[model samples]
Target chain A: MSDVYAARRGLLRDRCAAAGNAAALITRPANVRYLTGASPLGAVLLVGPSEDALFCAGAPTGEADEGRLDEHLRVTVLAGRGGDPAVAAADAASSVRADSLAVEEHHLTVARHRALRSVAPKVRLADLGTAVEQQRLVKDEGEIACLRIAAEIADQALGELLESILVGRTERHLALELERRLVDHGADGPAFPTSVGTGPHSGRSRHRPSDRRVEEGDFLSVCLGANYRGYRCEIGRTFVIGTTPADWQIELYDCVFTAQRAGREALLPGAAYREVDHAARSVLDSAGHAEALAPWTGHGVGLEIDEDPQLAPTAMGKLDACVPVTVEPGVHLPGRGGVRIDDTLVVRPEADGGPELLTITTKELLAL
Target chain B: MSDVYAARRGLLRDRCAAAGNAAALITRPANVRYLTGASPLGAVLLVGPSEDALFCAGAPTGEADEGRLDEHLRVTVLAGRGGDPAVAAADAASSVRADSLAVEEHHLTVARHRALRSVAPKVRLADLGTAVEQQRLVKDEGEIACLRIAAEIADQALGELLESILVGRTERHLALELERRLVDHGADGPAFPTSVGTGPHSGRSRHRPSDRRVEEGDFLSVCLGANYRGYRCEIGRTFVIGTTPADWQIELYDCVFTAQRAGREALLPGAAYREVDHAARSVLDSAGHAEALAPWTGHGVGLEIDEDPQLAPTAMGKLDACVPVTVEPGVHLPGRGGVRIDDTLVVRPEADGGPELLTITTKELLAL
Candidate 1:
């Protein structure tokens, strides 16, 4: 495991050296955790030049990145409180006599960047851009296993919720129950807020759970995910609240389910991101619901709930094998509610089996 | 209610004008919410030489900050997707013939700042610094009311957990249960991640709950807060697991309780922020436990959990009337765990009662 972290750091070092930077400072938490196996609060990873060093404001919590840290990386914990880790990392970079240092300009504030420049005036500063994020776009088998277990936890939670009485319960209560079940099934926490939108609120992406009660014959769309270890996976399902579904509800559900299936089927290695988005979006676009569609059809999900390779019309890039992404598509009629079906799938080559679905829950519209 | 938001924006405009900035763009979410009473995703507030406008990447969710928007502010929702709201606001500022504009440099990234400058080259960009944060230091009556309710909800949640069976439960389960109870008591959600540490893990600041279970004669520390409306309040307490607390546990709890009370008692209008921190910190410092202490003894809590007017040793500021802050003090002995006591209180004049304690949970150490 330590060797894995060392290998990741080696890859980052090669990229930095190629970009004419002797040292790279990773301040973003996810990036820091990627290069080093752990990320303590205000911890920064300084790689290459001489030796890799993890500069931190204080001692590691032992819970976050404890024993998993790479043995090859030097750990520097500051003695005082409220000191800037980025500044400390820059000073460390200066100590190593690095001529140039690369930093994540997208994540660093202008103030922090200026401070870093002021502290280490001799070292030229360059932007590392989204190099680390691009590196994290695809999942290793170990990371995929974490996502797979996360998806399974979410599936079990949602499955148990379906078995219990849900009618007349407020959206907030149902959401809370789902979250509790997620933990009961061994999730570190919810990937994001467990969105339980019912009635007119159904099918909306990122709906805040309200006190609205679940009613018979109303659409109930739930979007939830689980965080296991550090990886995150998302799953969403829509169902009718009563024993019999209304005609419009069934129609909307079928349309969304079909579009979602198309999107999932389009998740092939080397497929253009926009092409995958169009596969699902064209279905809804032809049905006259294009104006109300969300910005993105789906997005890559891994350590962070939302990552790279956005499945949008304007998105650039091609899907690679082992990249995990979510395929969520929905149509919401204003004041009438709608349906959304989502799944977390990993892109795999056709010979290896196309798009191994991590979220195995049945998407067929269920009436309960 | 709309007038309240307008008034806040007017105050900010006056400050900007005094600073020689004819236009100001507020991109920080809390600042945006404070000025316009709405913080739509990717929304930026431009307070300017002309009528103020809010530039949003998409339509408002109409859930959060929905009914509270100031009617006086013009809202410009971008028709298309994937446009930066800050750039749009800067362009709007340029259109209004503003010679100079101020932005929250502490919040904006270097890349984002560069993009804003490129789009609006005519306008000179100035750092807004902490002007908006300073304006939010003292709470109005309405904000105080929200904080009061948030505290009550947290107190209720903690009270209910005390009545349940807690022994042998994993720290994660306890934390999740407390979160559920917060929602049950009508909190929007937990203000921060609920912290539950058992035995050796107890009393550590910001300890991530682990799989540790409670045992006889162990110390258990729990810290949690509630978000009511948008206002947040926090409370923390520690208890003994068995019928009797060992001598050291009892002595440690008493000392922490006394320190917390001293800090609470020191919360008054015109009190130096560090003085309040010293009142509590001195207790632990005198006992030779200074090395294990956290950076800040306490901090202000409001729209965001940790706000300005931080109660720390090196902090510079005077507490004003209507300022809501927390005074949390603890001491953790390695391998033995320890005690922590915390509360949210509002500073008031001596004539009207020194400080109003919002978190009214009893401070006495309880043995379960």
Candidate 2:
């Protein structure tokens, strides 16, 4: 693991040197966690002149489940309370006599960037842009393993929930239960807040769990993921509440399942991100549900729940063999419920049997 | 409530106009929620010369807990998926013929700021520089009312947990249960992740919950809060898991209790922010525990859990009436557990009873 972290930092170092920067400061939490194994609160990774150092606002919690810092990297605990680690990293960069520092301009606020400049006036500031994120786009086998476990945890939790009585329970309670189950099955936590939308709220993307109880004829769309070793994966499934599904519910579920499958099938090495999105989106578009679709059909997931290579019409990129992405597509009609099917899969070559599905829970419309 | 949002926006508009800007764009979620009553995903508020408008990436979830936007504010749901609302808001400002626009530089990233500049090249961009945050410091009566309820909810949740059996339960489970109770009591959600530390993990500020189970003679420290109507409040308490606490445990708990009380009592209308922090920090400093204390004794709480008017040794400015802040002083003895006591209170004139304690949880150490 330490060697992996060191190799990752070395890659980042080469990228920085190629960009004319002697040092790079990583302030984004996920990026920091990627370069180093742990991301302490407000921690930043300064890679350059000296050995890469992880500057933290305070000591890491040292909780066993919350992974520790990679032993290969040096760690600096900020002495003063509420002091900015990014500024401390900048001072460290100056101390190392680095001629220039590259930072994630997209992550740093103008105020923070100005403070960093004030601390190291002689060190020329440059934008690191999405270099770290781009590096994270293609997951190593180790990262993919973590995502695989995260998906299994989510699948297990959802499977357990289906066995229990969900009727009369509020959407909030059900969501909370699934989260607890995720932890029970060994997850750091839910990668993102679990969404459980029932009745009129089902199929809505990123719907905040409400107090609405599940009704007999209603559709229930649940989207949840687990974070295992800092890697995240997502899965969504819509089910009918009664012993038999309503005609509209079945039709909507089948439509979404087909769209989601199309998206997944399109996830091949070198496929354009927008092409994958279009494959899924075209299904819904032909079904006359274009107006109610979410912006992106799906997106890459890794250290962060939502990462690079967004599968949207405007997204620009080509899929890599090892890139893990979620293919989720859904439609929501105002005042009436809809359906959504989502899965996390790693793009692979056709020779390797297309995309490898990490989340393997049955997508067939089920009546609960 | 709509009038209150309108009035808040009007005040911000006045501030921007005073700074020689014809329009102001609010991109910070809390600030947007403060001025528009609802902060939809990727939403930005544009206080334009033509009319104030709220631009959102997608339709607001309309969740029961997520309050609706102010009726007086026009809401523009972006037709394109994943469109940057800040950029769209800038375009709207330019369309209104505003010669200058002020934005929250402290919140907007350099990349997003550049995007705004690109979209509205003719419009002069000026830093709003914490203007909304300053206005939010001394909250309105209604805001305080919401905070009061939030505190009550947290108190209720903590009080119930005390009655339940604690021995042998993991910190993670206890934390999860408390969060469930918070939502069950009608909170929007937990204000932040609940912190539950046991034995050696106890007393450290912001200790992430672990798998450590409750044991005899172990110090158990729990910190949690509730989010009600967009207002957040925090309360923390440490208790002995067995019938008797060690002599050292009692001493540490008592010292922290006294320090927290001193900090709370020092929250007078005209008191300096550092003075309040000193009242708490000095107690621990004199107790030979100075080296192990957290940086800030307390911080203001509002739409966000952590906000302005930080009570720290180096924090500047004085307290004002109706300013809600948390005075949390804690110490963690490395190898052994420590103690932390926290509460949310509102500063008031001495004539009106100095500081009003929102969290009514008892400070006395109890054996469970």
Candidate 3:
């Protein structure tokens, strides 16, 4: 594990060296965590020829942080409160005689960038672009294991809820309960807020839970995921209340399940991201639900729930092996209910058995 | 209600006019919420002499927003999926006859500020400096009413939690349960991530909850707040987990309670912010706990959990009537648990009762 972080630093150093830079500064929290294993609040990672340093806001001590996760790195804790770690990292970069440095401009706000330039006026600042994120787009076996555990945690939480009565429960309470269960199942927390939309509110993307109670014959749509060891995965499913699902409910559920499966099966090592999106999107498009679709059908997931390799109509890039992505497709009628079924899977080569499914929550139309 | 948002906009317009700026752009979320009565996802308000416009990312709807918010103000929903409302407002400002436009430099990121300049090349951009925040420093009666309700909800949640068994539960569960109770009691949500620290983790300000379970004779400290209709307030209290506290626990708890009370009592209309901090600091300093103190003793809370009129030792500015602020001073021993007491109170004239306590949770030491 110690060698992993150090090897990543070496890789980044080589990349920056190739670009005519002596150092690379990482400001994005997740990227910092990936490179240094530890991210105290507002921390930054500066890698130069002579040194690799982690500059944090304050000391990182808590059961949550797992200190020294960066076994090969030394952390310099800032003394003053309200201090920017990026500026501190820049000063460290100059102290080590770093003449030119690469910084993540997309993550650093303009103000922080200017502050860094003034802190080390002699050093030439360059954009590192999404180099770290691009590296993160492809995962190792260890990263995939973490995502598998995250998906399993989400499945366990959702499975438990299916055993209990949900009628008359407000969406907010249900969502909160799901979150507590995620922790109970040993999750860092929900990958995102547990979205529980019921009845007429069903099938909406990222619908914030409301106080509305679940009634009989309503579509109870739940989208939830868990973060296990910093890796995230998502799973969404729609269930029918009462003993039997209505004809419309079954039809909608089957449609979404098919679309989601199409997107999942479309995942390959060399397919265009847009082609995968179209594979799922065409299913709904033929059913005359094209206008109601979200901008994207699936997206890559890793340290962040939403990351690179976006499976959108306009997305540019090819799918790569080991990239975990969510394939969620749904449609909602204005006043009637709607349906959504989603899954997390990793793209793989055909010889390796196509995409590896991470979230194994049953997508069958279950009537509760 | 419709007139209120319009009237707030009018007040801001008058302030900008007095400063010789023909228009002002408000980008901070809370400031926009205070002036517009409706907060979209990353929306900005541009107040012109003749026209007031609210620009947002997505197409917005709601009769109440049009009627109860600002009817006379034109609301423009951007046409694209991705567009910065601030830049759009700046372009609108330049095309219009406004000679000068002031923007919230602190809130606008360095990149956005430069982008705004590039979009509206002819517009003279000036620093709005913390003008809207200064106006928000002295909140209106309606704002106070919402904050009062928020405090009540938070108090209710904390009170109920204290009545439950706490010896075996983990800090994370306790924090999550308190949040659930807050929403149950009518809070939009917890103002911030609820803090629950046990034993050695106790008494630290802004401590994140962990999986540590409460034990016998442990000092349990908790800090939480509620958001009601966008208004927010905070309350914190520390209690022992056994039948009787240890000698050190009692001493620390009493000192913190005394300091919190003194700070609360100092909340008079004409009092200086530092004086309030001193009232709390002097008690702890005399007890030899000065080095362990947090940077800020307390701060104002309204649309934001932490706002203007910060009660730090070196802070400038004086208190004004109707300004609600928290007086939270704490001390922690590295290996031993500590205590923290906090409260929200409105600074008022002596004639109307010098200070009005909003968070009415009892300061009594409860052994749970």
Best by DockQ: 2
Give per-residue CA lDDT, model 2, range A1-368, as digits (tens): 67888898999999889888999999999998888887777889999854899888888775322455566678888855568999999998998799999999999999999999999999999999999999999999999999999999999999999999988999999998999899889897899999999999999898898888998989999999999988999999999998988778777888888898899999999999999999999999999999999889999999999998899999887999999999999999888978888999999999999999999999888899
Tens digit of per-residue lDDT, candidate 3, span A314-343:
889999888899999888776785888889
lDDT of 1 by residue, A1-368 (tens): 88888888888899999989999999899888877778888899999765899888876875344578867989888734677889988987887789999999999998899999999999999999999999999889999999999999999999999999888999999999999999999999999999999998899887889999999988999999999977999999999988888788777888888899999999999899999999999999998889878889999998799999899999999999999999999888888888889899999999997999999988888887
Model 3 segments more than 4 A misplaced: A63-65, A79-82, A94-97, B15-27, B44-49, B52-70, B73-103, B110-126
Please report how far candidate 2 places residue B210 from its true position, in Å. 1.1
List-wise, what DockQ does each model earn? Answer: 0.64, 0.67, 0.34
Model 2 ranges off by over 4 Å: A63-67, B63-67, B79-81
**Which residue window of length 10 is worst by lDDT in model 2 chain B?**
B62-71
lDDT string, candidate 3, B1-368, tens digits: 87888887888899999999999999888898888887776689999997899998754422223455656878887733447899889989988967789988767766577788898887888888888898889888999999999999999999999889998999989998999899989987789989999999998777888899999999999999999988999999998998988888888888999998889888898899999999999999999997788768999999999999889888888999999999999888888978899899998899997899999988888888
Score chain A of model 2 by TM-score against the reference chain A. 0.97
Top of the candidates by lDDT? 2
How well does candidate 1 score on lDDT at residue A300? Answer: 94
The residue ranges of model 1 lying beyond 4 angstroms of the native Cα positions read A62-66, B62-66
Q: How do the residues B33-98 of candidate 1 rate in per-residue lDDT, one tens digit apiece?
A: 888777887899999864789888776775333577766888888734777989999998888789
